[model samples]
Target chain A: MPRSATSSARPAGTAAPAHFDFDGIGTSWQIETPRELDPGTRRLVLDRVEEFDRTYSRFRADSLVTAVAERPGTHLFPPDSIGLFDLYDRLVAATDGAVDPLVGRELELLGYDASYRLRPAGAAERAAAEASGPAGWAADVERDGRRLTTERPVVIDVGAAGKGYLVDLVAELLRGRGYDEFLVDASGDLVHSGREPIRVALEHPLQPGTAIGVAEVADASLCASASNRRVWGDGLHHILDARTGSPAREVIATWVVAADTALADGLATALFFTGAHRLAETFHFSYVRMYADGRAERSRDFRGELFS
Target chain B: MNTRQKKLALATMTGLSISAALAGCATDTPSSADAETVAPSTSAAASSAASTPSPDASSDSGSADASSSTYADGDYSATGGYVSPNGPEEIDVSVTLAGDVITAVTVTPDATNPTAIQYQTQFADGIAEVVVGKDIDEISVSRVAGSSLTSGGFNEAIDAIKADAS
Candidate 1:
């Protein structure tokens, strides 16, 4: 939905106001400070969005993702992409290799190569893909400051976690502009700052275009995954198991609220395979899970601060 | 200032805090799979097979029971065809049964991508020949290596079809 322009910028701690839609992330912002998006800030935000799209878009020809597909090895990178690589390492360490980044080769075998294209459906195709060597999260990937290189020419589909990083950057951009109160959302991964808490409705995986529940948090980040989204048809989606070149089932969706977008993004996917019972041992943040059997569960530690 | 901008500011503040909460350092502890020491190979296969129930199945059926009900039978579900736009298009192909042999295939592009139009023009001819006669379960995603990613898109679309039908 589109947002109507405001007559005047409202001061902080005022009446709850109308929502506005910007750059695809739809949520009216509220803040404790009187910071605003000056011309410089606006340009910076737009530029950063463009940079992110160029770096991670699976379709863009000159996107970093494309470059990775063209040449899979450790190479220099722009700060944004390199930061994500570092975050990938963090996720890998946090999840004990469960969230590995070395699956480019396996992902290609599964038909998720550079173009994000699907393979021709046939027994031969399946057999050939299966016959491909078992390439886990170690096939090819290397990154340094402004340099990223891959071992092989495999598609590095960071769709699983790239958006969150972008959101973090957007928030950082706003903060850099001296705006203390703002909300940054990329698709669904979001981060909030300022005084009053924001209420975010977590979309129901089973129910399209509707939210299952709402969570309230101040100055935090939230990433939601549903067994429902990011999947390929035939029950396969993007959330593949690096070890086998297939999707991770068992857990349907996991929403993790944490302090950073990258961690939240990676944790949301990792949680799907981790399951609810094991969340405490595997995850360090609060989470919620919705299952295929119509069961919605949250971690015992998750603060129930939610909006109606 | 306008009401919209005011709301925007507030929203921004709240959203930032949420992000900050998630920004803490990644924990050193591994999730359950690692804790239980489940071999990645065994768990990977199990997870894949188990994820067959497309999460979107219920939503698809509620839209229209007839198309969905008929689709559940092998006839409408077995169809496999691809439509390529310009560069590479995301397509959905499913297997449906008609009579004894499986027939009917679907190839729809992911409208989200800008190049889907181009993919629709170029990739379909080669893809249709590869998938049409295959069983839904037996259908694999490797027959065409040159145009592989598009095939994965077709795979997801077909999976959605089967999930809706079942």
Candidate 2:
């Protein structure tokens, strides 16, 4: 808790915190730091985020993911994208196919397609969208190094974990350059760095702008998922339970804190299907899960203060 | 652990007001109120606090029954989280301090896996015999009931309590 005023390192002056914000990959990102970020480093950080969008964005025609989706044959997904595939594989297995990257097709069928239209398939959505089995994308797609192939048509959207992964990447960039104490907030998925723990408000699923409680995250990432936001049609939001080609209704919102952002982001989505204890077996995170009825449950390790 | 080459420990504490106030808080439970008090808007305050991982907002103010007490004679409680093969285990510990003596101790473990929870329960039920009446600092958190995951957070809470007391 030593204040900067007493630190010998800043005899000349104290470094006030600075923040850099920009929009990318469908969400805004903010970098919070205690020191001035040089112009070059700022550009590097910005470029890294834009790079991920250009590479994995399913909405963009120029994105590699779109290319893979449009082409049925085998293709290479740039070297770094392999890491993303690895993540998807693990998520598929970890959450019992609850967090599938191949869900892009399901999303598109429901009217959240690349054309930027919200044309949900209508009431018949249940019959038409439920064609694919749970986690079947795992089988449809094959990977060899950077190369990937699918037996049929598919659009892989890293949307769920993409922002989180990029957040980690930017956090790494900051740390690599010697800036230690910082928070990289990609939309709401965030990676916190430094010695002290910060308080994160668990957003209320039903009540917009209201928080269920507060959670603390120290040197870790805090990611949240809510079915209330990003709606396109009747009872539809971004988080589909995979088992059902519709939105998850059991758990309305989840806020999880883990050592990694992408992992935290994925786990938050998984909470819609599984509870705290079951998820604990595969991934390590502290969470607060709010049900549709407003009842909320939290992991014992949750570092933040809970309000009754 | 994914390496994010960041030095969150790098804050020079420049113009830091929170570190100066830590002296008064080392003993009690840090609650949401305390967190909000120091930095009303956790995100903005810490972001404005010159960026040092949000300052120890883990201190829950609701559990401040022993704020006036010290490690020599007071009470402390904290919740710690760790991962086991089952996923994650949360351990909550509350201890009473008498000088260096551990007047009382309670360990609570919460887990998703039944087997993991069993280990957590075993660790909780047996931890008192190892720490109560012993010097708080001397109590080494060895694996108990095969539940090693809960120890890190338990020990962390104890350390937080010790800091508050000493």
Q: After TM-score superposition, what is the CA distance of residue A101 in candidate 1 from its true location, in Å?
A: 3.3
lDDT of 1 by residue, A47-154 (tens): 777777777665568877677767656655676676777777766655555566655545555555545454424677667655744444444455556676656565
Q: Which tens-of-lDDT digit does each residue in A86-167 have in candidate 2?
A: 7777777876777788778777777667764555666566465455443365677888977888766677877667777888
Candidate 2 residue A163 C-alpha distance from true site, Å: 1.2
Candidate 1 per-residue C-alpha lDDT over B65-157 given as tens digits, one digit per residue, 9 for 90 to 100: 344333233312111122333332233323232222223222233333333432231121111111011221232211110011122343555
Model 2: residues with Cα > 4 Å off, grouped in runs: A1-15, A122-135, B1-166
Q: Highest lDDT, which number?
A: 2
How accurate locally is residue A126 in candidate 2, as Cα lDDT from 0 to 100?
Answer: 48
What range of 10 consecutive residues in model 1 chain A has the weakest lDDT sum? A24-33
lDDT of 1: 0.48
